[model samples]
Target: MRKEEKPKIDARLLELLACPLTKGPLVWDEEKSELYSRLAKLAYPVRDGIPVMLPSEARTVDPDAEPARSARSRRE
Candidate 1:
């Protein structure tokens, strides 16, 4: 039997996925391979190319602070 393939996410989809916290959108950092939630100010890591979207998997994000790539990735 052929194994089912997990859905592949791309830059476009990353633009669509949002952070559960603060109801804010997510930004993908291709260089660091992490997902950043602008509103939540938390950074979620991508494992083996898959984004761990769960809140538990997400680290703390200081909404008042700026990420290194915040200005650039805000649109992602």
Candidate 2:
């Protein structure tokens, strides 16, 4: 796959996948190369065309853009 090219996540496979924590539906973030569970506030990484579904492998996502917004404010 191209470096900037978004992974071609199969819709059918995504539909079959769920958050291991919440068992909730996940949103595919093609840009970030992750499957995000908003309910769980967790992002599962996709590496080498594989979904690392392990919760231990998952990481927390920022709930808001505080850091980015603060940096922008300082620049202005």
| Per-prediction tally of clashes | 2, 0
What alpha-carbon RMSD in Å does predicted model 1 have with respect to the real structure?
Answer: 6.4
TM-scores vs. true structure, each candidate? 0.63, 0.76
* Model 1, span 1-76: residue lDDT tens: 2334333348567667777777687766665667887767788887766788888887886676545664335463
Whole-model lDDT per candidate:
0.67, 0.71
TM-score of 1: 0.63
Over 18-54, each residue of candidate 2 has an lDDT whose tens digit, in order, gives 8898888777776667887777888888887688999
State the lDDT at 76 in candidate 1. Answer: 39
lDDT of 1: 0.67
